[model samples]
Target: MRIVAIANQKGGVGKTTTAVNLGAALAELGRRVLIIDLDPQANATSSFGLQGVEDISLYEPLLGGALVTEKIFPTQREGLFIVPADLDLAGAEVEIARMPNHLTRLAETLKPLQEDETFDFVFLDCPPSLGILMSNALAAADELLTPIQCEYFALEGLVKIVRLVEQVRDSGANKRLELAGIVMTMFDGRTNLSEQVVAEVRQHFGERVYETVIPRSVRLSEAPSFGKSILEYAPSGAAAQAYRALAREFIQRHSPPAARALEAPEQ
Candidate 1:
């Protein structure tokens, strides 16, 4: 299974939105997808229409308090699943501060699940910070997908994340982690600023930037309030189409062999 962490140390960049809707879109394509909400805010959890913090979450599992598989929960989607988060997860950094190999705890916790082979994709929605939680997500992830909002500060945040990824790798916290792709979110085709940001990001990241840019749409923002993804809430809308396209691109980029096979022949 491929583990992709949707991460950025900036808020309102559409990280959770990408995780929820993109993950749902992948499931729509018949992939067994698991979304682990690593953010303490649990935005991804509520986006999936689930509530309650309960005794199970990645917090407890990675900290050695509970079994990782025990915390796994099925969502409404047939093949999509989630390991929801809780407010208590915010305290994990302080609690596990001095624990040995704290940075690797999450990676170790996820080893068994990755080996299970039941899931084709695992999306970890990281919080908007470079704290231990984000570190854990990095440690657990095979690839990092950063969503850059179409705004003035977009590149600033992107640079920080690129640096952090370098730091993490250099520190031996997550040597195998590599950037899968960069997604441009909240793209406003009508705005010159948005166009500029997209161009800058593409120039910096080159082919790593996804061609499917998520447009700014009210429907995308409003879906989470109703506890649904754009795929479920407004499947025919622009936001849904954009997310579906993003998911397809993501799958193709990560699963090139499958993509090549599908393109191979009418034999």
Candidate 2:
């Protein structure tokens, strides 16, 4: 199994949205996907129609109260699962900072899950900040996927995250952690600014940037309010189709050979 931290210190960049919809899209394709909503806001939790019920989040697990696996809750999707978060998670950060090997706490907490390989992919939906939770996530992930919005200052935020990944590796937190992919979100087809941003980012990152750019659509923005993913709420819309295409490209690039062999073309 692979653990991917979907993070961006810059807010409104589609990090949580990507985690919810992209994870749902992969589960729709028969992949067992687990999302750990590391953000205290619990946006991912609400995105799936779940309330951030007390004692059901990673807050307890991170603080050494309960097993993280015990917190897993199934969503409406057959194979998609999540460990929701609550406002209490905001306090876990302050407490975790005072603990030993503080940075590796998440990694240690996730060791058994990683060994179990229960899911094909584990997506850690990080908060839009360079806080303890994000640091812990960076230390535990095999890969970092940053969702960058198509706007001014996009590259600035991308640079900070890239440096953070390097620091995570250099500090012996997780040497294997790599910036695996850059997802461009909120792409407005009618705007030259959006096109320009994508072209500029491509020029620098090349293939590291996925070709499937998520479009700016009302449907995409509205899905989370209804506690659904774009694939479920707007399957025929451009944003949904874009995410589905992204899942295909991502699987081809990152999935094991055996998993790849099982992949079928999109319907």
Candidate 3:
């Protein structure tokens, strides 16, 4: 399975939105997808109309207290599942501060799934901060996908994330965690500024920037308010189409890993 962490240290950049929509879009394409909402806000969890907190959550599992499987819950959509989050996760930063190897807790918890080949793709929606939660998510991921908003601040904030990725690499917490790609979100075609931002990011990242740019559509913003993805809320809208294109881009880029492995000679 290919695990991806949709992360950015900046808030309101469509990070959770990309997580929910891309997960849904991949599921729609006949791939088994799981979304692990690492954000304490639980926006990814709430986006699917799920808001429950009894015992199990990322907080419990990462604290080395609960099994990861125990926190997994089926979402409203078929082929899509989520390991929901809760308010308790907000305290994890403080709680894990005193613990050893805290940054690798998420990677340890996800080991079983990776070994057993449980799902086709796992998307981690990290919190908008450079805290323990984000570290754990980064350490556990195979690749990091950053959703850049079409604005001036987007590139400025991205430099910090690049530095964090470099730190993770130097620390050897998942040396394979590469910069997967960047998706430009909330794009406005009418604005030259939006076009310039996209051009600049693409110039910096080169092929790491995706061809699919998510437009600033009202439907994309409105879906989460109703606890749904654009696909479920307005499947025919530009936002949904953008998400579909993203899924296609993701699969097209990473599907080779599976195929190449299958073709390798047996030991």
Candidate 4:
């Protein structure tokens, strides 16, 4: 299984949005996907209609010796599951910091899932910070999927996350860690500033940046309130289409050739 951590140090960059919608999109393609909500806000958990599950959540696994699989819950979408998060996760950073082998705790916790091949892909919706939580996610993930907003400070946040990834890899926390891709989010076609930001990011990151850009849409923002992904809430809309394109690109880029060949016959 391929584990991807959707992370960005800066908030309001569509990190949770991408995690929910993209996971749903991948599920639509028949891939078994699991979204692990690591944010204290639990936006991704709420997006899947799983709120008020505070008693048993990611906090249990992060704080106690509870298995992550024990807390996993199925979403409305087929082939998709979620390990929800709660407000209690806010203290996890401090708690995890005090533990032995703290940096690799999440990795150790996820080893069983990795061995079991429970899901085709695992998307970690991380908090918007470079704290212990984010560090743990980086160590657990095989690759980082960063969501960068199309705004003035986009590059600044990107630089910080890139440096963190480098540090994690160089420090031997996760030697196999590499950037899977950078997704441009909250794009506004009408604004020159948004276009300039996308251009600048693409110029710097080149092929590492995804061709599918997530537009700023009211439907996209409204989906989470109704506890749905854009694919379920606005499947025929532009936002859903964008995420679908992103999933297609993601599969093409990440899936092995032999795997693609096997899927093609079924398709």
Candidate 5:
């Protein structure tokens, strides 16, 4: 399985939204996708309509005793599954810090699934901070998918995350970790500021930025409150179509040969 961590230290950059909706879009394309909500707020978990399942959350496995697979819960989408999280995860940083080989806890927890091929793709919704949780995710992930907001401060946040990714790779925690792509979110074509931000990010990152930018939409923001992805909540909306296009582009760029083989027959 290809493990991709969707993270951005800046809040409201559409990190959780991408993890939830992109996973749904990928699932719609016939890939079994698993989303692991590592954020204390658990917004990604709730996005899938899995609220009130606090008893079994990612907190248990992060403590290093529970099996990661056992925490998996089915979501409303058939091929999309999730490992929920809750407020209890807020204390995990302190607990994980005291453990031996602390940064590797999550990686070890997920090793079994990597071997078994439990899901074709696993997306981790990391916390919005440079803390233990984020470090653990960087250590475990094969690739990083950062979502940058189309705002004035977008480059500042992106630089910090890019530096962190470099440190994680240099520290030997996960040398194979690389950037999958950068996505610009909340884009407004009508706003000169948004267009300028996208242009600046593209100039800096070049081809690393995705061409399918996520536009600001009422429907996208409302989907999470209704406990559904954009695809299920408003399939015909612009945001839904944007995510669908992203899924296809993402697969073409990142899908492994085995996964591509599966898609070939369908095409």
Candidate 6:
């Protein structure tokens, strides 16, 4: 299984949106997917119609209170699941900081799933901050998938997050950590600025950036408000098709480690 942290410290960059929609799209393609909403905003949780949830979050798990599996809640989708987040998680950073192996606490908590192979992919929907929660998410992830908006400042923010990922790798907490991919979102086909930003990102990251650019779709933005993914909300829309394409491309790029290991020649 692949543990991917869908993170971008800058808000409104479609980070959580990618996590939610991508998880749904992957599940639609017969992959077992789980999204751990690490944001206090709980946008991911509410995006799936799970509201006013209590004691069913990762707050207890990260603090040594309960196992993460116990907090796992199934969404309406068959193969998709979620570990919801609430306001309590905002306060968890302080308490988590005082704990032993704070950075790896999330990793340690998630070790069981890594062993059980419970899901094909576990996407961490991180908050827009550089706090303990974000640190723990990076430390626990096998790879980081950041969603960059198609805007003027996207490149600068991408550099910062890439540098942070490098730091997380060098820390030895998760030496396997790498930048999995960069997803371009909020793309306006009518704007030259959008094309320019995508060009600049591809210039720097080359093949690390995804080819499927998520366009600025009103239906995509409205899906979350109604507690649904783009696929469920407007499956035939351009946004939904884009995410589905992304899921296909993602599967091609991020094959399970065991599969990759099997493919590696004896050396």
Q: Over 4 Å off in model 3, which ranges?
A: 257-267
Give the range where candidate 2 is weakest over 10 consecutive residues by summed lDDT.
258-267
Q: Looking at model 3, which ten-residue stretch has the lowest summed lDDT?
A: 48-57
**Ten residues in a row with the worst lDDT in model 1?**
256-265
Q: Compared with the true structure, what per-residue lDDT tens digits does model 4 show for residues 112-159?
A: 788787799999999988888899999999999999989898888888
TM-score list, all predictions? 0.95, 0.95, 0.94, 0.95, 0.94, 0.95
In model 6, the Cα lDDT at residue 260 comes to: 69
Report, for every candidate in turn, its global Cα lDDT versus the true structure. 0.87, 0.91, 0.88, 0.90, 0.90, 0.92
How much RMSD separates candidate 3 from the native structure?
A: 4.0
Q: Give candidate 4 regions above 4 Å deviation.
A: 258-267
Candidate number achieving the greatest lDDT relative to the actual structure = 6
lDDT of 5 by residue, 5-113 (tens): 9998888789999999899999999999999999988889888777778667778787866888999999888999999998888888889999998998889889879
What C-alpha lDDT, on a 0 to 100 scale, does residue 146 get in candidate 6?
92
Instruction: Give per-residue CA lDDT, model 3, range 7-82, as digits (tens).
Output: 9988889999999999999999988899999988898988887877645578888788878888888877888999
Give lDDT for model 3: 0.88
Judged by lDDT relative to the true structure, which candidate is superior, 1 or 3?
Answer: 3
lDDT tens digits, residue span 1-267, model 6: 889999999988898889999999999999999999999999999999997999889999988889999999998888999999999998898998988788998998898798887799999999999999999999999899999999998889989988998898888988988887999999999999999999999999999999999999999889988899999999999999999999988987877788767756799
**Candidate 6 structure lDDT:** 0.92
In candidate 6, which residue ranges exceed 4 Å CA deviation? Answer: 256-267
Name the lDDT value of residue 229 in candidate 3.
Answer: 83
lDDT tens per residue, model 2, 35-120 = 99999899999998897488789998898888889999999899999999999999999999999889998988887797786899
lDDT by residue (tens digit), candidate 1, 157-221: 87888888888899998898888789999999898999999999889889999999999999998
Q: What count of clashes does model 4 give?
A: 0
In model 2, the runs with Cα more than 4 Å from the true position are 257-267
